[model samples]
Target: MSECCCGEKDIYLPELATITRMQHMNETELFLHLELDSGKELGHMPGQFVEVSVAGIGEAPISNTSSPTKSGFDLVVRKIGRVTNAIHAMKEGDKLGIRGPLGHGYPLEDMKGKDLVFICGGIGLVPQRSLINYVLDKPEDFGKVAILFGAASFEQRLYQDQLARWAQNDKVQLLETIDKPHPEWSGNVGVVTTIMNQIDIDLANAISLICGPPIMYKFVIMSLEQANVSNENIFVNLERRMKCGVGKCGHCQINHHYACQSGPVFRYSDLSDIPEAI
Candidate 1:
């Protein structure tokens, strides 16, 4: 096994992790809490992803949904593909192969002392939640934090209990909206960007982190630009088609950049020149 600078084993070799908890968040999403068999931490940063493998079903790249500061790790898997479907069939005590904590994560060190704005849509909130909780865990390490979350409907929302708790935290300002009004919903009704105006932060200086559908990026960037947030201050998590977390495969290549290696999380300014990136 290859060794990293910290003397950890190769990232390509899958490690055994047992599911400590499993819950269905919605119709398609499954939340899993895992602990390594070696009794060691996953040592993952906020936006990093792991390659989860089922016995004969192969592996898929999944973003870590829990913060590094937290024990073990978490993942929210969407049942959209074969590998993910196999993962969904797993039980609380089942073991799976984990091959990462891969790729670059969000720049938390740079974000220190800066006002933060997190814009998340649908299941995209899964990855962004890691950083959100990281910041919230140490409120004194950062400035003001505002979270703007948008879901398709009341049934599509993830982490309902956690969202309510975040809303109650004095360190955070949380605003949630649905795409359309439902009989059971009385919250704001509109697209995620529609509620961007409700965020009260120093737009020009605050660092904005966005994660969601591909379509949401264009419009959300536009909204941030309109508010005068510079591209340098805006980071986006682009967890695209990353087949190999080590970047040997070209599946996640965008122009000269590889999402699996150079990204998955990048400053908007660094990706501005790459038309295929956004």
Candidate 2:
């Protein structure tokens, strides 16, 4: 009923975003697409996340995989804890609170004209998909592009339809693998790091952005280094508990850096000294 900071009138303050779509992508993963009455675009950059709240149940930080250009956005969530379990029970059109498209996103400006290599693992592919689809929309703005994705198993792959389209792009080199294989799967079978063996990188001109669990980041960075990519050119997305999307909540801090504000996306150069980043 009042004017908002952006000079907009009567925005829904995020609490009114009725869940328009909700589905289970896997046994452990749930996808929620909310349509807020705010009528304001998320206006977020790729690699960012949002804080979702379900009344008395509490809240959790979930990465946004759908590009900002997409109608609303998509959150690929894996329920491992309490708050997530409540989120899983929600049905379409259920109301929930959403704050942000928070945290720094990928270095898209720096990516212009650079050969971009995306190394995504597990649910890590969610954030990577945002940057991937964005880059594809502006093809000539980049140089040689490649995507190397790995997951725990064939059954856990996310966004299989879009992955197929990316594979069809002549200018993009797409390679995907899984640690364990299924009978119908014909792709490589090993950790995602194994795909590194199939591509040649000009470390001087190449940049890699990776997302995954702690162990995956450890080994992937090692592989990228062996391929000669400088530590400075490597970026990562760090996820920690986040309550407030803003800096007020102490949950997302890692020492002096607030993962909600300063990251969720960060270059290795800035993180090289932060052991917790591992």
Candidate 3:
């Protein structure tokens, strides 16, 4: 056991954490909660991500879905790649390599007292959930919160239970939509951007965060600007094939920025000059 930057003592390098629990969000999706052997905390910021590795497989950049205030962090893994598939097969008590609650996390300091619009698409909610839950913990530190989420289908919705709880919160408004709807569905059906139409833009003192696939950003950004949110006030979370979890890896490079370090989370202003960011 070693220690993490969070000051928890005897935490192993990078750290050796055990799989405390696992939940299947759907047929091809899973969420894992790893408990550190030293009983130390990951001490991560909301929107900060982690680098997880499975022995004999490989590593993947994953977001910290749990709030920083919580004892252990949560990672939502979708079985689209080899490492994730390996992760999905593991159960409680499995050992894995952990490096980081790395990269620059969300800007919680700037968000204080500002109305927030959380526009998420697909598994975008997985990363945004970190900030969303953090805001809920200290509800008074922020203003109104609206979550606009979209997925390919209902079955693809991540964290359905948590999203429902957000919708139930008086301080939060969770608006969700699907690209294609089933006969049993009745909510917004076009896209996540459509929910933006229902918002009363409070751009003078509001901030917006957008995350999802690359294609989702083009339309979402255009819609946010129309609602009067400034380029500086809007943030986007970019996904890339990250390695090293630090800037050393070239895999997540966006012009001069390294998505793994400069961010898996970024403000439009920081990346406005980076052509590949969008």
Candidate 4:
């Protein structure tokens, strides 16, 4: 069989994967570690996603939270509807059907030699984490790296352990903010955009990337531009309901582009072409 762009031999059929480990991030969120049943490498890019299917239930486009360099890939899930609810009920050793690593990924080449900023809000950290780890694994290729995450409260934060370790690194700057007040939290308490004002960013040499709730896009983009980051240098990950990972179904289309085919990761300069891209 010929290989598709995502490195899988077949793009339409689902590959069976075994869930080997599981961890709960909060009350409603969990991360599952998976290994392909056939023992093949996923070979997914940092921003790509997989359409995960349960036996009787349907499938949903799930972002890869774990880094491509890690031993096992990760899928972060939040219960929303039927498919995700069934996925939430599954545990380690369960079987899952997957079909991707689909969609365009971040512009790693364009990111070379530039200072980096990652803005993640809520569960958006899942996809952004992939790129963050990629940069960390190859620090010599880039300049200073910074990650900023926003949560409504301390309990809503994801990747706590890694965040702590990353924050302690002098080369990797990490900052977080909470929307409302939490006296005991003792950390930044405001929207994530506010953190932009505090970091010493060299806009001339910086590239800003963001992945967050749709509502957060407008305000966040404004902040990055105000900081002098070029529209072409800023990237955003937009997750859509990609029913058919191959793009036969029209669910993931955004005007002329299909989110499942052309993107999921788009530079602000490209996003300007689609009014509904945000």
User: Against the true structure, whose lDDT is highest?
Assistant: 1
Ranking by lDDT: 1, 4, 3, 2
Runs of candidate 3 with Cα error greater than 4 angstroms are 1-13
| Candidate 4 global TM-score | 0.94
User: Backbone clashes in each candidate structure, one number apiece?
Assistant: 0, 0, 4, 0
**lDDT of every model, 2 decimals:** 0.92, 0.82, 0.84, 0.86
> lDDT tens digits, residues 1-278, model 1?
64367876565679899999999999899999999999999999999999999979988999999999899999999999999999888899999999988999998899999999999999889999999999999888999989999998889988999999999988789999999789999889999999998888888999999999989999999999999999999999996789878888899998989898988999999998999988
Ranking by TM-score: 1, 4, 3, 2
State, as a TM-score between 0 and 1, how close model 2 is to the true structure: 0.90
What does the lDDT read for residue 54 in candidate 2? 76
Instruction: State which candidate, 1 or 4, has the greater lDDT.
Output: 1
Candidate 3 structure lDDT? 0.84
Clashing residue pairs, backbone N/CA/C < 3 A, model 2: none
**lDDT value, residue 160 of candidate 4:** 92
Model 3 misses residue 86 by how many Å? 0.5
Candidate 3 clash pair list = 1-10, 2-10, 2-11, 2-12
lDDT of 2 by residue, 1-278 (tens): 75466875332244457778988887888888877668767777899887777778877888888777788878887888887888888788788788777788998898898888888888888888888888888888887778888989878887787788998997788889989979989989999888887765565578898998878999999988887779889999988876776788688788888998899999998987787887
How many Å off is the CA of 250 in candidate 3?
1.5
Write down the worst ten-residue block by lDDT for model 3: 5-14
Which residue pairs of candidate 1 clash? Answer: none
* 97-177: candidate 4 lDDT, tens digit per residue: 988788888888988888888889999988988888888888888888888899978788888998998888777878889
